[model samples]
Target: MGCCVSTSSRSTCSTRSHGGAVSPSCFEVGFCGQKRTKRTFSDHVIALQHLPSVPNRIFTNGKSRTSCIFTQQGRKGINQDAMIVWEDFMSEDVTFCGVFDGHGPHGHLVARKVRDALPLKLLSSMHSYQSRQNGSGRTCFRGNSKKSDGGDSEKDGSAEDRLNSIWKEAFMKSYKAMDKELRSHPNLDCFCSGSTAVTIVKQGSNLFMGYIGDSRAIMGSKDSNDSMVAIQLTVDLKPDLPREAERIKRCKGRVFALQDEPEVPRVWLPFDDAPGLAMARAFGDFCLKEYGVISIPEFSHRILTERDQFIVLASDGVWDVLSNEEVVEIVSSAPTRSSAAGILVDSAAREWKLKYPTSKMDDCAVVCLFLDGKMDSESDYEEQGFSSATLQSNHSGNAVESDDGQKSEPSLQRNFTVRSSEESDSYGRLPPEFEGNADTVAAEDQNWLGLEGVTRVNSLVQLPRFSEERPNP
Candidate 1:
């Protein structure tokens, strides 16, 4: 038996499955406007009757039978981190998980939007590919053959190779579609704002991962000595990487770090020092797309083993301060499976204060999916009367301390708009000194400081119009 609540009408409907019955038995909990029909096992509940397109399982900031998710706002203006765990995603044996980190003025919205839509796009692409394969009378996991020296050809490679190829193509198509959608969204301005996504799909014993930006995914596996070890699963796509920097610079995008913070390199416009994006690839930030910034995700595949204990997906906030080993240790030491994500987030918050007292804490989000099932057993610490409520209250997005160190009620929703003055003559226009001096500006090291929400200066610089006749680098 289960209950469904309708938010629009503030009503509840109880459903029970009868033995050997083919349908649900529904009972209305309250008096509704419609007359109650005779109760029958075959009749569907009015409250439960809804669109077939609705997602059946979507978990955020909560715990499921095999996973836990949590996010905490930082000292920044708003939390720009989002996460999800969708079980039974494409089939009974498949699951999807992702973590997104948004940056710039409207980052929170972009992150949330991607979290809710990217999976659906990927699913659609996968189905389309399968349909085409079926129509062609070929298996989806088979690729074209390559001619050999003897003029004889064979299948491209092994089954695993073909599977990887299929998923990589799906990821690329979905990512491209997602970015295109963001660019044309009427209500969203993605010229100077964007989000990072690190997603993974688990099908049976295999894992397919795709990601952009600094957010990361890792697995915790048990060693021969029964010690838990952390294995990083994705590369952090920062602008400082050699390949990334070379591409950006070749396309006329400037890549450099401010003198004060040489460790963090950023991508800027060719002629203007603005919108210092820290990542090499991301969704949105169209102004930089022509200059080598892409939404293409790096893809990888791994087969799960008996020793694999769990997987952790987190924003850079957690990775900034917590090492992979530290994160694995923290999650392993958690009092209970349901408390793992909250505890990991809380630990990151404390680390931020200790490591960067002067800098604002970045938003943190985490998703923990346990594999072995044995980890869900109650720990001895929980037996000592551990209070799960206290842990959740402290880390969950609820009444908490604001950036100013004051107690305040958390706003359920925040509204932001680009000011009319900001959109006037000053908007998307280069300053006098920057005009026709692209060479000089590109030669000099830019001193743009800090990422959005990291330092006093805002990294979300206004866009600048590009000259059509500008020479290539």
Candidate 2:
């Protein structure tokens, strides 16, 4: 017998799954009157599979308040962006947030798939790191420990090295697993579809960011003179960059800008230009996988201080119309925490109408995380003339100190390429022969960011198989 569950006070009911989960398509009439289409519901289910089981705590945290707003591109069939904002993501003190921008036919599905699964996979990798270290009692990183002139090698090197090594391994493996999961999903079609991801996991004051493609993470802070400033956190992985174009060309892919949009360089097939991808790295786009597009993410860290006010994560829609400084201004001047994202989206939508009257507006989604509970007005930020010396001094160098007083470099800016089959597992682990050589690692060689193995792709050129639960989110 099937069970019926009540979602709220309204007279609506949804079927409960006994073992297998119920399809997300079945929505009660009046309760969910504004019903989502079949495709959209499917995408939501795919995303919900990996969401943390914690109760809804949206707009609840006093110190670290969070809010989100997603608006469809004017008259576009559906919004292709997906976002996740978890206040107590893994633990009470940890908060997790992500923004995904999808493109191509099945881009929405691809974005939802990553939104639901990436975080869970990352947590599993974290567990694996702990397990490996517990069994071995040694660090996994390779390279000569770069020492500071007056710093103690013993105290500074031991703990920070172990943690950094653990995080690097976890990030690489989790991302690899996410891509593998997408490629293996039977119902979903990803041959020409892909998504860009920008995620942040904040524990205490430490911020760990994992980013791919062009969606961005930026911080709004008070400078030395107490003037609000915008600090870009992730590099925009657009095909226009020299390094990105070079890599794409090396892999036999073509990079060029369309006549109308000369500023936006895109990656295309050497022989065909049907699917010109605008980003250099992404989770799917299997058609271009062999042609230079990859799933590896750039990693960075930041130690938040009193001057840091808030952080913003948004899709290109917001970035396209609003400057980083403008976004900071809008968010800072908002009346309350719950309304900041909506205000930003509304502002962008207006700009889209005014600037590109003939073009379809891109979907806009924004996530604002307020570090300090106070919401200051624009005038308050622009009092100006205050010396930004202290704020500048704090971030002058990329190095950040953890709560425990150990200093670690916040940005790990390395180029990630597709791996070969002999390289690593789906979790990006090195094939047994490459383990246990921390002393021999060469700092100059940027290729070995994860475990010892290389990247690989399946050669079967066909539609993906369909299963109710194969990819396992």
Candidate 3:
């Protein structure tokens, strides 16, 4: 007999197997079997509550028949990283890929929200821009480009250049609209939470990219001597960058490194030292928007060549422990095209444990897009092993001593804590949540800042007060 369960709002039931498990026939295999059938009443309710209004064509799992994508949760808490790969995105030959790394209390939700909504926004903007061009009967880029002197000069550039211009405009519009929507979201509290995005669109031989934050993208190509070489495609938008730091300081936001972790620079408010965000650009984080933190993505274009093999988009988790050369070598040596991303992620996880035995691992996400439609033979490079020299110079900055006098680097998984006015006396004491065995804490409440198991110092040196508003005695 079928079992029935009822709640205050509704009722549900289904045939159960002899072992009390959900019937296998009722399950629908999602892309790469990434999604499983709901087995309980609460699971079904949660799925129904979060269903998207519009269907998505993007694949989030590495097991997809069409593309490669994978993500692993860290020891700290729920995975705050997300990724997507969409084939035939806007046209028969175009493709879209992105990776996001989230931070703060609601970071995981923010990352997934951007993964589902950002691509749709880009598609809509592209359609609207095309409509405007069709009506005006002009080939200019929204009146931003200089007018040609005469003749066919306006259409003289190569096809690649024209494609880049159109995509650049679409990316700008979509990113701005996405950030605006996040700010007004009724269910999300984005005052201190945010995410970083590294996205790319490949139309035929041209590749256009728009990104914000520390997540990165890189390309692997064969050199004249048949050796695979790594080419970094995006610059990490950290607060330490000269231009990024200047803008924040101009808006009265303070930028500096803590005495304990001197290698990592962070951005803080003028009156309070809370929310020491490491990245200079990100979605949400409404608190810092007024202090020069912007969502405008840095854009770039690359024309693919016969030598280019594949492109990898990943969050800082992967980049933190692995260098560009090491990542490229690992992907190139994968046993099969479908297993490339998974192998790389597993390798990173192993490295985290080996390098920082005492620190909690960070969430890792990766997307591997092959260009030649086939996997190359394994190279003759030595077995997977990390050199001490490479670890000291990973992308963000050089290595520094931790509070316990151990070597460490700035991790993208750093924590963001906001203290209330009444909690000033408990500044140096560890929160009760982290008092016992660290691994025993709930995933949602795990702290990313104290990964090395060290006590945190209060970031705020002095509190601000208003003198003129005092009551007359």
Clashes of each: 0, 16, 0
**After superposition, candidate 1 runs with Cα above 4 Å error:** 1-56, 138-157, 373-473
Local accuracy by lDDT, each model: 0.63, 0.56, 0.61
- Tens digits of per-residue lDDT for model 2 on 1-473? 11111111221223221112222211111122334332221122212322233343221111123343333443344566777665544333345688888776677667767876776677666545544554676432211123334556675467445545556667788889889888988887788777889988765455678888878788888879998877767666766556677788999888886674444456877666546676789988888888888899877656566787888898877766666678888988876655577678889888766655654566676888776433333343224321234223221211122223323222111112221233222111221222443432211211111112222111111233333443232
**Model 3 vs truth, CA RMSD:** 17.7
Candidate 1 CA-lDDT value = 0.63
The top-ranked prediction according to lDDT is 1
Runs of candidate 2 with Cα error greater than 4 angstroms are 1-53, 56-73, 136-158, 373-473
Q: After superposition, how far is residue 363 of candidate 3 from its true place, in Å?
A: 0.3
Instruction: Looking at model 3, report the run of 10 residues with the lowest lDDT sum.
Output: 23-32
Residue clash pairs of candidate 1 = none
RMSD of each: 14.2, 18.4, 17.7
lDDT, candidate 2, at 79: 60
Summarize candidate 1's per-residue lDDT along 1-473 as a digit string, tens digits. Answer: 11222211211222111112111111111222235543321233212123122343333455654677888887766777788876555443456789988876677778877876787677657656655665676532211122234423334345556677778898899888889889988987777778899999775556789898778787888879998877767766767666788889999899887776555567888877766777789998888999989999887777666787889998877876676778889999987877789899999889877766787777789999887533343343245344465334322323232234533332122111111222223212222333454432321121111222333323343446564655554
**Order of candidates by TM-score, top first?**
1, 3, 2
Angstrom error of the Cα, residue 64, model 1: value is 1.1
